[model samples]
Target chain A: MKVQSVAVLWQIWSRKSFVTSSTLRAFSTSLINPSNSILMSPSLVSLDCPDTWTSGSVQSDRSSVQKYTSKHVAQILDGKVMAEEIRSGIALEVKRMKESIGQVPGLAVILVGQQRDSLTYVRNKKIGSEEVGIKFLMTMLPDNCTENEVCKALQSYSENPSVHGIILQLPLPRHLDEGKILGLLTLDKDVDGFHPVNIGNLAMLGREPLFIPCTPKGCIELLLRSGIDIKGKKAVVIGRSNIVGLPMSLLLQRHHATVTIIHAYTKNPDKVAHEADILITAAGVPNLVCRNWLKPGAIVVDVGTTPVEDPECEHGYRLIGDVCFEEASKVASAVTPVPGGVGPMTVAMLLHNTLESAKRAFKFS
Target chain B: MKVQSVAVLWQIWSRKSFVTSSTLRAFSTSLINPSNSILMSPSLVSLDCPDTWTSGSVQSDRSSVQKYTSKHVAQILDGKVMAEEIRSGIALEVKRMKESIGQVPGLAVILVGQQRDSLTYVRNKKIGSEEVGIKFLMTMLPDNCTENEVCKALQSYSENPSVHGIILQLPLPRHLDEGKILGLLTLDKDVDGFHPVNIGNLAMLGREPLFIPCTPKGCIELLLRSGIDIKGKKAVVIGRSNIVGLPMSLLLQRHHATVTIIHAYTKNPDKVAHEADILITAAGVPNLVCRNWLKPGAIVVDVGTTPVEDPECEHGYRLIGDVCFEEASKVASAVTPVPGGVGPMTVAMLLHNTLESAKRAFKFS
Candidate 1:
């Protein structure tokens, strides 16, 4: 059987056709025995195929029917491509706003302590914001910066006429209280959407947050732009953290999907996971979800990016997502790759949120 | 089969023994056919049974064995009793505060427009507050009051030195945006916990809201006071309203329960409800959940108080909860009765929150 368009793939995924039932039964068996759940080899599901997509344990999307020696693979939910598309649109908007308002949107980031990951995130945010013509400002404080200093920094950014959005990078020194510092950001300037008020609005049905957390917003954007309908679908989110998991689940629910959160205390996580039509994993545990944990033709979003030590790689470490991509590719109809997946989208979304905050602040609309 | 002692009943609820496995299988059949879910003759699962305390459902407490009935029943999670107990403690604290500080805790309520239910609630709140020696100050506005008028009233209450807690009654006139007026309430004076900041705090894991929404807080109080272990339990909240369902689900999740919310758009809600170990319904749909919708021995908290027209009842209407009480009693291990259940606890919780706000404001221990 050859499948060409995503619409067809969605049909197969939603219908759970006879062709995929055997593969599903096998995957179901793995759920019953979680120890054997992981598939040894990872397969990259490429949507860049116009070929015979035959049903088999080891399938490929190569154009030649004769090359179909393997099982059915997943279609890649290319976040990089989507992020680039969004960034382009945001850039156009930024240009329009600059022309009308005589100033570009500005985003301020306050980073305390020198954590490698935090530095990388701030750098990416800066690059992404500049790419979209947003004025990027960074406030770096010493490792031993007092709580008053951090609060003062936030207060300055919040009051700055040019700064439309403010973000305080996470994982401050152990002694510093993140909540107290985050609370210091004015709700209007809280571009990261980490403030309780912003999050609270997101959780409420009738209310809308000025900004949604970048990563989750990016995940939902990918799904929406891909023509995936969230309403009435069983969307299972793995993890319950405020940043990604909790808000993502709430967003999906707001879109009319039935959401179930599988957390640390959840019993029979694998079995519960198999029931989801759309599965999103944000639990930073690398390779925690195996191929069998997903229902056949399920759409998977891997938000986890945990760096595991690997001397063979240039960085001496490789970032792995929560899901085992290879095995998952064979089972899930669509899946996101770690580095190119949620990572780029998250940065793009941060700029998008900043732009939005700027538009509201300047009344550019 | 007569069983004595709540310990024996708890064992039956938790163990899923041979007797209940068969019972569960029979009830599980109702999922495929919701029309047949409600049993014709509902049996109340009572704890008032007599017999030597046995391991089975029929075993009764030795002291109460003589009062045992043939049919299995649920133990009532009496909210009235619990709320009264909480109020007594709060009252003592109020009296102590009056003695020490020469003034009792003060709660100011601002009510706009005259809705019958809203007036009733306000009156009840005043009586409850005064009964506990709390200074009750209420600001009543006309039905045609402007949004500014409402905000000005809230401002007055916020500025009142004696008023430690301020509540703006909800469902203001349709012309007025409740969000705008609600935003005016100071976070410290937001005793209702409807402020975005407070709700946001509640949604966060490490941070606690200054005040939890009265209704949901009361529900959690009932569960905790009843000794029901919330950890690792499968909790299903039926509704996503900001007031009750949303916060209740968050509270349950915070307690380490794997939580799922079933809303109006949810497909196969009955199937989802059947999976819950603890079910909380805030759907406001009268008799929406039937006996078959529950897993045998599950605990239920019904937050709905819909006034349905009933000619047989005085006032030409009767209050009904989301759960079909008579039907639910047969399946649930324990269930709160509608009238005396979450209703009274809600009021008590409002005062409890007010007391807490006062304690914080006055530096009372």
Candidate 2:
């Protein structure tokens, strides 16, 4: 598992880089004015000629800067609303297939161990599949199961012919080798699309993945449904993890958007974040994206899922994403909330992916 | 074939393009001193904003001006020299394999048409295979051969125990379904590395390919040999063809470099090109990367193969790469010559790939 060297990987990211953070912040503040002789690009990013690279000295030219207006309201990309719409689209397709060919899609779910979060996720996935009228198979393996036992369970489902799509619930018990198990699954049945081969395909230009991971797909669906122009947009993905942020950058670039990935170790993450036409944050940090860390009228998609204790709520804990939603709504155009933004759409897409997998596998109507 | 729409593609590129020759020339002049005072990242680029999004300008204060020094000449990266070293390395390995295994690696080349360049390439490939002591098999089918014929030829070689590597020579009798036939070749034996799946793996971050297409591999090998630091460098590939430029960008990025790709109809190709620490030109346009366009000390890898009249050579026409070699060499700290640069490395890598395929398939030392 990559986790064995996880400490080394984390250490690589923990060091304070050579560039000064305060210098970067000051540069960002200066770029805020609309008409003070705009230095088109900062030298910080220029890699052409270090000898010729000059520092911008303060000139006494303070031209007029545009003032912000309060009329702007956040265009909530309510994922719950969009997810329901997509579910109906899938349901209609499923119904059509059943009527014409009597073929129904089937998805097999493998969950190892009894982690509370994993149980809840597996349950939600099962419910979502049912709602879409796809046949679902669930296998619960004990925490201490051997690799052979897990392999046997996977082999049966893979050879079952009835099982079209397969998903192994993530963050398996501590003893398991995650990468090996994920790689072992058949490419055709890998609904999560975490297979390195599939990911490798996604990174290439002109090659499309059989299935893109759900969150990135969900983000695309949200953008396209909202009629947003993705082409050549200055998009910043505020994380570098494989599942959400990296794939999101590739997908956005494929749609022709110019993308930059800023992560925790980035020297000036906030300054970089502010330059985005579209900002998608999945850093799992609370309030990492402040209102000031945004360009006016930019679209924001926050994918973080952190829980905060709230005594007033009956559940005692409330869900929140990485963005400061209240502040973002005041300054920027549109935003997706923590609980309803990307969360609901992820499950809805899983069902969508299952139906797709079955139809492709069976040559159904 | 993509050729059907290529004319329209060219028309689209030639017209409605904001990429003026004058602007390209300005970028050439600005290569000397990067003036951060004036630039607009292509106007057609999106903001993902609503109709009510107001236009704003950014002020450039001197205090805000950053010291921009391009870390251009980290070291010299000579592709031609490195290619010779790699070829010799492969020769030693092949000799050892022949002695121990009692069989040499064999590569089957299937050519379906008589495209002048394709024939020339096939002849050279055979020569290269012989030089490396890898057995070369060439099957020249007629231009009128059906798609099934090509597939059958590939399948026969795939089944042959002696055929360690296979390639369906490209520009493949244009009428044949190139995609389907190429897909049929076993991924393990795909020496051309053009199979979309193999190309995908090459472009992925953590994924590794059994065979990386020769040109990009040569480019990286050159940089590594020259002691150039690629990590965290900003690289821009000037063309988006699947063969070289697009994959080149992805490979650089996967190595932790920030990469940008420009293609036909790209609004500002020159602006993007200036950002590269390692510049690779495969556009086939003669003299594409000129003296004015080069950032001093940039490592240039030339992969263009345009035949231009040169009575000085016995062939009556001389071979030239995408780069204006003479001018680029003067401005660039190091540059690869047209004939001697990337060409030899490509053939060498093919030999290396066949050996790699044999090693993995037979588990040889």
Candidate 3:
């Protein structure tokens, strides 16, 4: 019976091999020291468990035993569904505003170069605007556009009475200074929330930013709509990019979570990630999170959408998130999928911010 | 002998009452759950002791065992000493600039009201500037001064070719909009780093601010001078105010530390503080940090300088830091004392920022 119990224990314990190694080392050390009889109490805990360990059913039990085992499959957050709901709500608001004020919200997107990714993003934004009844305007400049040329275009957008929001698609050109060109856009018209004043306000307490960065804002919306409570939860954000990780952490902190950001320079990231009740990864590294890296039943939002070669797919590439989906889905309580998750939410948030700007500009309730 | 060991364990454990309660709950639960043998190992860790527990000699032996017990007295992170060293360095650089460029740095201070603390701070900054050979200029306005008056004073200073930096003493008359008035100052002349653009830069990655907030910058300087490694460490800042807590948290995050801020709404601040390798308190609550509120051997910086009733002193009230100093000294690895720690450093950082502004304005190396 003892031998059979040990084998059962090994099977259950092997799943938590990464975290339990230190505990096992302490247990082994206690065996060598007679004075460590009190320490033996922990090892005896395994002896009391029945051999009825099953990896398939977690709903039947909500005890620590179930928590320790990686048998639970996460419920999908479904950002796509939430975003569609928000877009519909925004469309209703737009309709009401246009009826009252006889003017629709307008957004201007400035694209400098022929970068395929930037062009695609701009097109998606335009489509989102059209769906929401927002007037979409675009300013396309050559690859060799000067800083002055970019600044001139932004100033025109800022001065235009019809344009309620202006966004400069990032990575303008190698020769032009991005900061200087962005600074030319008036604060009220900076819909992307990249303006320093907006970012500074976001960092300050008792202050409100004109707009939160769309991607991070979307992550927060996903958590909120899915009923994931952020207050006092241990949240680990992987990546420190300004657009995603930095602002995501700030938003989480504002929501009163104990937030930690793990960047490329971070040591022992897996250990940190495993300790979090909520884990958000924007590291752009494909499949960085496996089952072991997550706390059992943690809430996860994977922001990374990297294109990896896959002959099995028709496009010759498939989108993979920072999290290993198949394995992580078994451990996390709720997880946001890569393609259908944060991408649509970002576009939705952008439209939301533009609508807000128009309302404020037009003096509507 | 077993009873004696238990008693001794109780005494040591009681010192960490807040933290050990969770541990004890986990231990007692293991006793109830016969299946949790692995959880039992942690409870037994208290049994293997050699009866040589003493709280006094922690300064002598800096080991892991010492870290587990709240016996070690913290080394003083003396900000006075560091500030003196920095001021001397700044003075030497000022002398070199005078000899090379035949021009010395100048600073302008704008005081809107006659608040006692603000007056004292402005006076100390003047003294520090004079001691460092920088030209000092001041413009004092009455409590009833109009917003235009403040803006006019700021504009004059901004246009002055000799003035390198401008600072507005905080707590401007309650009626005036502080943010709007401050925004009127040109970015280059804004040395206080409270300008939205400067703060925005501080919040963003890959961007550097023209000046960092003085108090937060001083905290970083103290930590750096004390040889405290920030990278990969768990840091907790107890406050969310714009000037101190918010910027301090941002600065720590920039240094690559896993950071958490415990604001008014945080549910388990004590547990959060106990887990931090580095803790900074700027909440302005006197004696908010108790001995049990720290991880043994943790580094602490108290930014709160609240005036509390002290009838024994010549003055009826005395300045007390947010931390309960006597108790915290016994638990922390290093701690900054109230009056001498962050105060002098704030003044020193002001002078340093002014020098940097002058260097940048003059295009000097």
Candidate 4:
């Protein structure tokens, strides 16, 4: 994965640190434990993996785990590479479906306002969709559009036979009820999966989600690409936003990773940061993390992206992530830098989801 | 607050011998150690109350905890009465709103199929809603209704000015997609708060849930009613179902309790249970929990209700919860029973939500 992709995934997961750490921890420890009834050991969170040898058990590398070995560290979770892989996979499926079923996957982006960031995001998403071979369409509604007008327009698209997936850019106009406006998308066509039902299903373990949030999806892409063992590892997510943090934690916990979420309000946030095998920092604060807050050999994902003034930069500013990269690089076994980390991954996942929507719509998967 | 309630609460918290032994060991040895972040400083978990001094510390007597003199323990939480209190609170608001605003809270129940249990649950929920002074309406769709038809009906209720909350009763016919139906409900009218947006919001600690699921809501009721201080305590949620287990764990974690979710497919489920100050069992298994599964003074909320044949009972069947109530009671400081414990509280919370929906619709608040 590209370094940029990891940061985006990190930000998403960091948003869920407080709750994810402890829950994901239970998953890892419980995997090898056999003391409780199997009800808690349902097939999904089955801890049938290798028994965590006693704390004193010998390792392939007898050196302290603080030192890296093939066993301790695998390939970096490059979201960029993984995103390419997913897009390529989707493109192949799109090609196959076009030939075999005479249909293509379709994703419709709904932009309600003219925010520059939203515009950049949508443009990237559209391009990503095109790259992945999913059919893409978009609509721009005026900022002053009433909730009913927006609802009516969305209803038409939702009922349209050809539209398989729909996404309305975030930070919709102030007058519209964000929740109600998002509700207008069809569940099957809800490419963003911000729909409450998908979220509810995601929250419930053992159930599957129609669509997962983009950032968490990106993080999962990192984990799968890196071949890291999430089951039973202590994962901490920082931040608690609906878009990134909460759902990211749920996804990790579903994979049986014990997860903890740390938030701005947490009394001892720093103490919580040190407990992670996987540390995700999504709070937007620049240089919020120091070396002491990290455990030895931890894999860190930095999700923060703040503009800090730099005299050397031509733009008069440089993009910085939530983590203090200089300090973290030494303490963390490996870390994803801010600008090149999770950002790229989010775009890739969006394309991936759009492709998925297309495939499901076309009955290709 | 009351003798019976305190016993039930204690029985809910503490379960069995192995749990007690391991917990006792962990508690006694950890307070003085800096590495033990899992257990926080003594001052955080408990208030400056008498029972807290005893229960919050190690080696506190099970019998003594029964007294629950702590402000956060026996005196603070009582799920049964607390649920009732919440219901009455809602009822009072509902009555006031009806008198002042000429509008009653309206809840629409969509019951699909003829599963006996599902039907019973829907009916019970309807009764509970009416009892709280929320207007209840039912739409019983055929068991074999098409997913599209269900989606349309759910949408209608979501848009209908009369309906403030819409509930699609669970265990829909196997042919209909649950995700699609859940997705169609308007997020604002999603009183159950099963929608992804709401759930995604709930999973992040600081974000407030627009609607909290009935099961987890009920679990909170159990604790608040039983006087258990959730802050900075070790909580374990057994089962990771999005409905009861995962959300249950997250909500507890939000209260500042360190929560772990043990689920099926988890490597070692029982070992995780031993670490909990509070244990919530939501896996739908009968007698899944034995005395050995619980800590002596741990609180247990058994959310599962499974039916088993019992020739001794006149009905020829008996309902049991996830915990072995009788055996667990002796060992646990408090326990919620299979039939009467978390079950009623779910309905009560639903009613409260319905009333809330009405209040919001009428601007009563």
Candidate 5:
């Protein structure tokens, strides 16, 4: 149960006015040039050059400078639409399996504690699974439950023949050893892809992981579906969490992108970020990346989803991304929006992984 | 089974004259300044700035310019000396175990082919093990040996009470599935650390690998013993091989170094290499890196060892490194020599890993 810090909220609030103003400007620009609206932005004329861009800048040139002023408003990647399409395809596959073999994929989740965000995430997964015609199951435990209780729940899932994919929701209670719990899950049933062997396969050359952690897999899906080139591109991934950033970097490298990983201990992250032809930020720090941190026309994928309190919103809060959306949209060639971006795709990928696992189990594919 | 390319030999021969001239100059500088000889060199004054170093160079400054001309001759990171020290320490520990419990560690190696280089390497491991009071065993098979034979060999060592560490010599015959064969070795006895689970643990944070691959572990030891600071430093690794480059980058990241991996598809590798405070090259391309590829005062670890024909030498060939030794010596603060550098340290680390595995098995401290 990690809480958003006050400093992060303060930073998001401080930029709220700027976001509003820039959104209006972007909208006006789009209205003025409807046909090429996705690539045209008038507000980019005033964008500042990154601090690292100097006369002797290795990656900077007159052409890059000229291209910077001709700002390309980022086309929305629209992961929501992509995920919907994918889910529909998955639904059809499940239906086919049901009609042919009278069987459907089964996914089980073991969730401990009652963290609001985790609860919401689990609910979404359940809905997503059920919508795809897959059976969904969960085991919820109190926050103070013993390690043995959680292990028991995992053991049941592992032994169940119907359970094709099992996910142990992360950030387990403080007392339980997360690694030990994860190791106990049968490798073939580890749909979450947190097992060491799965990760090792992902990192190694000429080997494939049983499952790629959902978020990074989804991000790659969005990129591929958008027809963006990854081979030989310079990719920079911010944050090195095992789930997102680390695996994302490895996946990108597998796709032949020259990748650099920036973490908390990195010096001058902006300078490194600017070198990226494709930038993926999973720092979870809202507004951490600004316009100056980008290379103009670079593809930006924001995996950060921090919830900030907003009394005016329907849910009394809003999701913010690592990038300032308005600022990034003015410079990047394409960008994924917060709520409509990686989130939906992550859920979609989970369903896809489960279906694949079930298919393997049944030897149907 | 891997042979050096003719193009690589030609490149080495072309650079031979320059290496000779610079070595003499370096020798003269050392003679003049015997007290501070390790850091003083006269040849650095003529070194050229890296192509990426421009007026707006993010990492370049007046101090860097002055430092460039100061020409700090690289102090040798002597793996030979370090390996000797470490082996002596292992010998004492093995003696203590023998006296206290009447037990000693045993290492088993399975060599599927009689490749000259692989045979030499296996022989060295045997000598190193025996020197440290560990029992040494080898199972040699012809190049045409069947996959079943290799698997049977691995199974025997795996079940043997005396054998604590088992190494499957790499580059198996073309007919054999390398991964499938390596997988046959039991995890506890996987001293070479090629097991995917071991690599996954090394890559993931908050997890520990049972055994780290020998070469990368030895490179880190060299840097640590040389007093080179890794935390927060920009480290660049050239090549992405499973055994060296991939694990090296992950290990450096674990040490808090901001890591960037450069491979064949990487554009402008020298520009990225120049940004590193610690540069490790395992590209296997002889003299692939020059002075311009390094930052002044960078610590370089050369893992490349390509054999080039030399009738004058007793072995009829000499090993060449990826970095031009003379050029790197003039610019870098420290550099490891190809043959006596990572090679010996790798063997020492193998002995260390075997001892640790044996201790764990015997329940010895």
Candidate 6:
């Protein structure tokens, strides 16, 4: 058997002091226990081969000639590459729709505050929409904007004939009522899928929601595209946030996966997590999931993207996932990396939802 | 330690063949492992003492002089008694409101198709309402009634000032669109809490629903009244029907329990069920949950009520719970029985929700 040794180092930065520490880890590509490889299906292996042991290390020179053998190394579920492929396919469909009917999908966003992360998210969404040939529009409001102002903006987008999908960027000012504001968005144009009706439909059996929340949808897409069978699988989702964790569990259950949700108040979380065949962590706590939290040969999807300040990085901060990537590779059969994994897929799913809304509105199938 | 042995025989009747086989089992009242008693809080023990080893056997003579002893005998979570206490409280409040304000809470039901089970449920609701001083009204329609007739009935109740709450009996005729008809119900009058908006609110965090579904609410009431702590507990809910299981799981999560939902496609369900500190079975399959499926000292809430035909019974049938009561009594710390357990609690909760709706309508604090 041909063995490949990959040495990777991750710099852990403390949130308070900005102090960093690095640790080196290596795993082999060889399958140590063939019987333990539950997700090593032919279709998964084909997509897994290209980015199998790619490291998210900031320094490229960390890879060395030293050979370190381990039982198994996880196949990387590369959302960046998958997202690009989906975007390209969507772009072609958008072009064809434009040529045939002279109409393109339009997505409008209501950005409440000028939070740095929210701005970056809105920019990425705009770029992703443009990449797919979808028209993008935004209504910018100040942090001190009243509820009426936000409602007016939502009403405008809702009534606009060209606008197919509308989203209100979250984490509004403390003065504003988030639930009341979100409830005002028209159900037809709610591409973000935060509306109560959409959530209810998603949770219920024999009912379909107009849209599924983007981040969870992206995670499921990554799994399906990689040919992982969700039916009859034991799935554990950490965190129960409405945006990601709650909908993610509901979606997994819809796919016939027995799902357990672990929240902050949950006791013995690791014990619960270790029983999962498929584990999705969106707790937003850096390095919350360790090697012991995962079952051997379990597929892991990390949705957490906590920002830690790092002086060595160009962006002044590094994105850390809930799972310890260096540790997870040795235990998990497959894992998704932060920054390049669920993040890119969330943007891609948003574009997909927007396109779907437009198609539904136009009765274009 | 003083130990008490109780021999109980349950006649298991198969649905296809009503051939009954009686099995005699016995359990001790003594605490076998003191350290394993997680729910042995003082408040819980008090409620556990009364009706601790009561049996639901149809034959009274089966409680014989068999001295077979086991680790424990589960405390009966008597919903019938608890529901009566709640109804008395509601009755007092209703009497006060009627005397002082010259108004009383009114609940209207639209019953389409005289399905035997539905008719029995509706009749029980009416009797329960009258007992609690709540005005009850019903609209009867034929089995082949049109959707428009149902819609008209719903509209009349929705517009009526006297009717504070309206419930359209579930399992409507085959031809009528359930979702569409449910959508027509006024949000304020959705006392049954089947509306998508209410369900969505229940599923979401930091949002309150107008009404919670009766059965699940009743189950939680049972736990709380028994002084069982739900927070930080491992809960497993079997079956995911929109009515009982889904909302039950969601409600458990709201109380901060680490919840796992097991549906038909779930693999190794007993393994998952064995880990729960709180196990609620709503699978509707008689005796689906066995002794091995439960964790030691786990509180079992059996929501299943599958009616089995019997020639000896007064009603020509007997209701069987999801858990095998004889087996569960030996392993579980506490368990709810069918027919007299969650059944009466459902009616109590329905009246509670109706009174609340009236209170909100009248702006009475």
lDDT of 4 by residue, B173-238 (tens): 889888767877887788887776777667643346677776787778667656677776667787
Off by over 4 Å in 1: A1-70, B1-70, B311-316
For model 6, residues B304-323, the per-residue Cα lDDT tens digits are 77777888976577777778
User: Using DockQ as the measure, what is the rank order of every candidate, best first?
Assistant: 5, 6, 1, 3, 4, 2
- What CAPRI class is candidate 3? incorrect
lDDT of 5 by residue, A1-365 (tens): 02111112222222223224434444454456544222211111122121121112223113343265554578999876666666666776787789989899999999999987677667767777887799999999999999999999999998998889998887888999998989999999888787999889888887778888878888888998899988668899987878888899988888778899987767677888999989998887778888889988889998887788899975577888888999999898899988778777778788888998898899975
Interface RMSD of each: 14.3, 12.8, 15.4, 10.1, 11.1, 16.2
For candidate 2, write residues B109-129 as lDDT tens digits.
998878765666677667667
DockQ for all models, in order? 0.22, 0.07, 0.17, 0.14, 0.26, 0.24
Q: For model 1, what is the C-alpha lDDT against the true structure? A: 0.72
Ranking by lDDT: 5, 6, 1, 3, 2, 4
Q: What is the lDDT of residue B105 in candidate 5?
A: 97
Better of 1 and 6 by TM-score: 6
What would the per-residue lDDT of candidate 1 be over residues A233-285, giving only the tens digit for each residue?
88999887778888888788777778988777676677778878899987777
* Candidate 1 TM-score over all chains jointly: 0.80
Residue B164's lDDT in candidate 1: 84
- DockQ for model 1 equals 0.22
Candidate 4 on A147-168: residue-level lDDT in tens? 8877777887888767788887
Where is model 6 more than 4 Å wrong at Cα?
A1-71, B1-71
Scored on chain A only, each candidate's TM-score is 0.80, 0.80, 0.80, 0.78, 0.83, 0.81
- Per-model TM-score, in order, reads 0.80, 0.75, 0.77, 0.63, 0.84, 0.82
Residue pairs with backbone overlap in model 6: none
In model 1, state the lDDT of residue A102.
91
**Which numbered prediction scores highest in DockQ against the true structure?**
5
lDDT for each candidate structure: 0.72, 0.64, 0.72, 0.63, 0.76, 0.74
